[model samples]
Each structure stands twice: as structure tokens, then as C-alpha cells.
Target: MSCLEIMPKLGLTMTEGMLAKWHKSEGEKIEKGEILFEVETDKLTNEIEAKESGVVRKILVEEGETVKCLAPVAVIAGENEDISGLLKEAGVNGQEVAETKTEEKKSDNTAVEAGPKKVVVIGGGPGGYIAAIRAAQLGNKVTLIEKEELGGTCLNVGCIPTKTLLHSAELFSEIKDSRNLGIDVGEVSINWKNVQRRRKRVIKKLVSGVKGLLSYNKVNVINGFARMETENSLTVSKEGGKSEKIDFDSAIISTGSVPFAPLIPGIGLEGVIDSTGALELESLPETIVIIGGGVIGIEFASLFSSLGKKVTILEMLPFILPPIDRQISSMIADKLSKQGVSINTGCRVTSIEKGENGLKVDFTKGNDNLNVEAEKVLVAIGRRSNTEGLELEKIGVKTEKGRVCVDDYMRTNAGSIYAIGDCTGKIMLAHVASEQGVVAAENISGKNVKMDYKTVPSCVYTKPEIASTGLTEEQVKEKGIDYKVGIFPMGANGKAMISKEPDGIIKIIADKKTEEILGVHIMAPRATDLIGEAALALRLEATVDEVVTTIHAHPTINEAFKEAALAVQKRALNSVN
Candidate 1:
């Protein structure tokens, strides 16, 4: 008798999982407890072990294919056993599903319905899902297509997860010093597993809310890999079923970015992982060596260091937070150094090697060759736009440097097709992507809108969060703009001082002639939340005098903003100018 293996439910809330990789080849001898495959669910990869010993007969699901729970994905049987009937019963020929995925191009000749436009959005990230909801709100029939989980990278592996963990770390740090505030506290240690469990719960709640929104807005969601069959048509492939053809009057490609991996030796080694892997690690390694000192690495450094983990950051550049203002970047590096984070900027890593302890990283700075060893290595260089499976080139959708090319209105070369979010490589932030999604959806619904990049804010959620909007001082200098700089330390703010979180500074740049706010950069607590004011000021083209005269409430962190604005004209009250 043959044994059928289906996609098992890994969690109560997981309706489906992506077969990330098969650990064993077809026809390979199987062991009862040996690893068989990996299933990605809840943003974590879980190894699915073989339940019974048998020769593998067939693998029905392909890698990257998403399969629903309880769906037969493979078959194993005793040698010489009749498996044909079982295969027939399971409806998994493998070849049949493969054939359906390679079907011919679908023509965009569907009869137009008089009621509403038919819209299909691929990739349910912050961008894609938001676009679907907006389109539906505009009286369009919307279908959202996602290969794996919704909420995309931001909710799963990127923004939400990082911030959640950071909050935990911050709370732990706060408790360690509670006695200083005259509060009696006993020993408190992080229940790491509980922290992990809570992170998962938060994510599940938010994802369910997003899905609920989609349902309420009347957006039909297809869970499968989508490939473009035509400008107005797509072929979605499921793990254990025939391909589905979806046609629309318009489409959106929000398929976001994947971690940019360099071709260095030993990068594929056992303990070397990417940003997503770092987020899902079950336990803290004794020490971690992170490559690249960009926003991702810096945030991770903040996270592990707060928990008293040994962390070393290696960067090829001259400084960390490369895009930030030079002086503020230097300040952040110093603060992180004070936190015991070993930062080696201008250190070019030539290769990573497996070491006796864990992993060895070899690099050189100028004439010096150096190395560091740690329990794990994280490659956090950056991200690249995901555009492979969409088949953009086949339909004349233009792309530059592997990113989908779109105009100000998010329209691709094909007028009926559009792309947004990380895939377009426009500002690779979730908020930016969400705004772009709105712009794209509005344009599709017969509204004219263009994305304004000038006021878009970028934030880093490290200890003493960093944020910026508009032109940096260096950029203004390069543009030959006449600018005046105002600076105020957070320690000068009464509210910040009282809260015991007074570390870092605020720097504002204003045009000397126009007195208009050219930029606002901060390295202070809750900078991510505070940057919204700067974004709005830039959007409204507000001037220094306007902010200074706004009469900020007393003993509030926001008063620092007005003080910094006053410093632009050398009239600061609470702080010396």
C-alpha cells in the first residue's frame, strides 16, 4: 500500500503553507524520523519530518509553490507496491500541474461589464493589499493575488517584527534601571520564547485585521504564485491544483524586494543567514557578526546589544547609516559604540569562513587585514526588487536595473499595467509603498495623481531612533542652496530629561533666503513617531518662523522642535544658540 503525505497544518491559524524546499530527492530512501521538507508558515520555516519509512515515490509540489492544509502534496510507497491508484486518488500527477502552469498567453478580450472595472492586484503587501481596498472602494471588482502570506515583508519579516522585538528589548532595558527611579524590582530576565510567541500573536492579529478589511471591501484573494500571461491577464499556480487564469481591465505588481545576497565564499554555510532568518531565529546565538552597517544591521545591533549579546558590525563604507546626515551619523555611531557594539566601518569583507567557534569573517581596512568570529553571521547588505516570476519583459513592461519602471502615476509601459512598492524600487519604505499604492489605485479609477517624493520620510528604528525627510544638509550643499542649520540636544528638553531618555540631538536645515524648512533629521527617542511633523512641514513648505511661533505645550518632547527652529534664527529660549 502507498502512503500519501499532504501539506500538514503547522499552526491553528495557518490555512496554507509554502513548500520552501524539499530535503530529499524523489526516489531517495526515506527514514522515519529524518527531515523530509520545509514548510514556511507564520513567517518561519518549519522542518517537516517523515512520519513513516518508505521510498519516496513522487513530489507533487514544487519549491515556492503554496499548498493548502490537508492537500496531498506527495506520495511514498514500498518498492514494487502499486501506487498508481493512490496517485489517481490524490490527484497529484506533478506533470499535469506543471503543464497547466505553462499555458499560452490569455488575451484581454473579455466583454466589459457596465458596472465597474475588473482589477487584479498581485502581491498583498502594504502596497498591493492597500491598492486592492482602494480600488474596491472606488466601485471596482478587485482580486488580490499573493504567493505566500499577506501583509508581505513589512508585517511578516521587516518593519512590524523588528519594532515588536525592539520594544521588548527596550522594556527589558528599562526594567534593569527601575531601581534608580526608587522602584523596588527583583531580578527580571527575558523569557525569550514568550517574546517570540507574543511577536507571532501581534502579527497574526494585524494580518487577520488586514484580511478582514479585504473581505469587507469585497476583494477576492487568490493564494498562489502569479505570472503574467498578458498585460491584462495572469496565471496563478497552486501547489496541488491546476493553474487559474484571472483577467482584468487593469493590474498592479507589488511584488516586493528580497534580501540582496553577495557572492562571497561561505555565505551559504549553515549558520550564515539573511535578515528574514535573523528575525525568525529561535534562540539568541552567543554572538552574532553582522555584515553591512545600514539601517537593517544597525537595528539588529541595537536589538541584540540591548539583550547583552555580543555584536560586531562590519561595513565597507566609511560610516554607518550611510544616507543619514554626516554629523548625526557620527553621533549615532558613538552612542552605539558606548553600548558595546563593535562597529568597524571602512572594513571590506572579502569572505566568510566556517570557524572553530561558529563563523569567521575576514576583511581588510586600508593596509590592515582583520577577522572576527561569532556564533552566527547575518548578511544585511540591503534588498533587491523581486521581478523574476511576473514575466514583465514578455508583455513590454519596462524595467531598469531589475526594478519595474513606472512613471509618476505608477503606470508601466503597458498603459493598463502598473507596479508599486519595492518592486518599482521607488523609496523602499512600507509607508512610501502604501502611498504609492493609493496613487496607483486612484489613477486606475480615472483620477489624476502624481507621487511627491520630496516630503517622504525614512525612519530607522534603532535605540534612539533615527529619521529624516527632505534634502540632507550635504545634498543642500551639493545643490548650492543657501541654508542655515539649527541644532538642539535632547538633554535640553525638559520632558526628555525627566523621562531619563535624553540621548541624541535634533538638526534642522532651513533655506537662508526663504527661511523654509529644507530638512529635519533626528537621533532621539521616538524619532520615528516624531518625524511625521517634519514630513507635514516639508509637505506644506512651512518656514522656520512658523514652527517657532506655534507655541508648543510646555514640558513636552515636541517643544524641542520649536526650540530647534528658533535656533535657526539664533533666538532659542530653552537652549543656548
Candidate 2:
């Protein structure tokens, strides 16, 4: 039988890569260790070498096209050997390859759905809009309703806006330290107005993009608040006393979330603002006190501190980023402290009061009562699911602690009703919601799709960004799994040293008995982008040896991930074992 040559995983985090060039054509003889093709990822391009000596039977994947990691890109065999089965297995028919699995599922679903369904999705956020589009693509008549802006909180006031500001903050912080990199640029200053303007521009562009996508998908979008009267019927009320009734065979609720405001005294004061208000600040404060030490709070702390604003964070939890791996969280805390951000954990905010300087934040740490004065106080405590006016109860849809309840398929208790995203309160990240939306839409389209949270990646957009996927060390211990850990410091990475960003580490944890990779945590430059590969690893149940054998491009930050995997077996080449 002819052997298949697949697109090799070039790095630990790489799920797919672009076929940049082909060194060998069909029928060309190639030897082991000879360059076969070049693959390009966001990090770097690497020439992939052949593993077995053979004549290239057929080039399955063309250059400039992207192929998934481990998917057959070409078939290699000896002269006169039959390779028809290999090409068919690679989804090659003549010169055309198969469409994506999602598209294939849609085609199957279209065949299953003898008639189009009137699918209604409430709220135009990441979850709602995605579900609406997917439902439409699955040959359904889909309608989406939202009172505020399209793209919901994430695009309007959450992820997009916050990341935009953080990018500016990171730029300013980097330029200030650029002299150390032999770039002697003097007089670094932040133009706050321009920063805010750019943030708005980015948000506007994203919101417009979402609108365009909805239109292209043929999803009917309504600008109003949706209230469910029955499982199959709802009413949408618009501004200026306009109302319309919508009847559908199926419905998806994706109302998203709102920032939770604790009942601390003076929380409603002028200077005390929630995350939404913080994003809309007219001017940057000289000093800011952010209450909460979760992802949102830590990101804002990074933003303000990087811009030379005095930043203080108070958290009721014993530690910051409690959901993250303890070691990674501790490292981030240390870095934030070094950057002059004061993080006070295991503290409860008593009150916010007006003071001589700007605003006084009073909190207690154990037996000590402490106060910090700042120009503005931001409440980043957390968010609660936004199910207001949804009237899910009217339709007998169950809700737990103000969040919609749903099954793995995102179906609600009420017949033909589904819920996704923050409204369900199952992992509040936008990406999670989007996936849940897909699950809900596909299920509604007569497909058996379920949402999986096992490999969801959590990201923190701070200096030396943090991202993690799969079980944490604590969770693994609680589950009583015997696991081995590997750690690689960025100080030893060539790219980190060249970029002067050698202040993070990549950690990998795998099952000792089976060598299955259980978790991957990273706090390095481009860590957010790097987590995708880790997520794919977890999804595919990749083993430590699998990661170690993957060829990582030299002189790149991604090589640290491979080194970390090697460390799992005490055999890391570039770092101390």
C-alpha cells in the first residue's frame, strides 16, 4: 500500500498551516529528510521534510491552500504502485477536494430538513448572530432580534473595545522600553483621545462586519427587545412604542450578560463605573482603582499601569485569576506588581466615598481596614446573565440563578427552544458562546450536534498575555489523575530574547500513565494566539510524545511550546531539564 504524506504539525499550537510552497511535484523522487513542502503559520514558515523515501504519487493539497494538521496533503508511493485508495481517503476527487466538515454537515442537514424552519434567535451577540447565520445556512428562515447594538456586548463594549485599548497601552509601554532594544526613541506619550478614537473605529468596523455577515447569510435582523410568550411565539418591542409578533418553529435565546454591581456603598456614585462605563470614559484618569481581580480586572490593570496610570486592584478572592492555574496566576501577579500595579487579594470592598484627592475606596484585609484614593474607581467584579424581558418562565423554560438552562445540545426545557452564550451562563467567553450557538443551530436543523467545553481556551490580554486550555493542575489533582508537568521559561527562547520579552513561561501537563496531554498553560508574548494549538491538542487527545515529535520552527516563540512538551519527559533540548 502507498503511504500518505500529510501536512505535518509545524508547532505545538498549530492546528493548520498554509502550504506556502511545494519542493516536490507528483512523480518526483524524494528521500527521507529532504524538503518536501513549506508550511506557513502566523508565527513563521518552515520547510517540512519527507519521512519516507518514495516517488510523490499525487499532490493532494495545492499550494496557497490551507490544510489541517495531520490531514493528508499528498500521497507517496513506489513506481507502478496503486494509490487510488490513498487519494480518495484524502478527500481528493480529480483536482477538487472535499469542503469543510461544517459545510458537509450543512449539506446533510439540508437533505434531512424536508422543509425550511422558522428559526428565531434573540439578541444579536456572538451567540445569537452565529446561530442565526448557521440556521440560515442550514436552509432555515432565520430571524435575529436585539434592542441595543448588533454584535452585542462583546463587539460594542466588551472584548473588541477592551482589546483595542489594551493594544494601545501595550504599544506605549513597549516604546518606553524600546531604548533597551537599541531603538533610542525619545519622548513617548499616549494620545488618549486618539486611542479612544481608534477603539471606536475598531468597534464600528467589527459591528459593521457582523451586520454584513448577517445580511449575506440572509438572516432577518430586528432592532428590538424580544419577549417570549410561548415556546413557539414571541413579541418584539421597538423604540417609540412599536411592537411586532414573531412566530417560529424553533427559537434560540442568546441575550448575553451585564456587569454585576455589588451593593457596596457609593457604587452608584459619579466616578464609580462598571466595565461598560470604563470603556466609554471620556478621558484617562491619572490614578484608577479597579475592584475585582478576575480576567476583566487584570486586563484593565494592565491597560492603566502600562499607560503610566497608578492602578490598584482589590479582589475578594484569595488570589487573582482564581480560575487559572495557580503557578501561572502567581507569575502574572508578580509581573503586575513589578509593573507598579498594587493587587490586594482576600479583601472585601466596604465602600466607595468621595475624598480630597479623587475617590476613596475602602476595603478590609483580614483585621485591617485600608483605603485607596484614585481619580476613578472601576467595578470589575463580574457579570450576570442578561435574561431580562426574555420571559422564559412564561414559556416554562427553566432558569437557574438568573441564567437560562440548557442541555449539551443547547436545547432548553421548553420544546423547540434553545439557549446559548452568556445567557446560559456556561462559560461566559464570546468564543464559547459562538460554539454553543453553532451547536444550537445545527441541532435545530435536524442535526445531532452538542457543545463541548473541555477544550475551550481562556485568554487574558495583558503584557506577556495569558492563555490556558484543558484542566488546571488543581483540577487534575482533585480528579485524582497522575500527571506530569513540564515548564519552559521564555528567557531561554531566542525570539523572546531578541524581542526583549523574556518574562513568561509555557507549562504543559500530561497524564503520566497514558501520556495524554491534559492541559497547556502559557504566559508569553502572543500567548492568546498560541492557545489555539493547545486547544486542538486537547481536542485530539494528543500525547506528550506527539507534541515533542512535532517540528517547531527555530528562533520563534512557538518553539517554547515544543520545549515545554519535551520537558514533560525531562528531555527538553533548548532548556535545562
Each prediction's TM-score versus the true structure: 0.80, 0.82
Cα error, residue 40 of model 1, in Å, equals 41
lDDT of 2 by residue, 20-63 (tens): 67999988999988999998765588988987888998887665
Q: Quantify all predictions' global Cα lDDT against the true fold.
A: 0.87, 0.88
Candidate 2 ranges beyond 4 A from true positions: 1-114
Candidate 1 C-alpha lDDT tens digits along 1-577: 4688888897777877767678888889898888988887533788898877888888887664555677777788887788888788678544444343333112232111123589999999999999999888767899999998999999999999989999999999989989877787999898889999989999999999999999999999999999998888989998898799999999989999999999998899999999899988999987999999999999999999999999999998999988899888898899889999999998888899988899999999899999999999999999999988788888889999889999888988797898999999978999889989987886776544578899888898887889999889999999999999999889998888777878888889999999999999998878888899998899879999999879889887788888889889998888889
lDDT at 516, model 1: 99
Q: Give the TM-score of candidate 2.
A: 0.82
Q: Highest TM-score, which number? A: 2
Q: Which stretches of candidate 1 lie over 4 Å from their true place?
A: 1-115
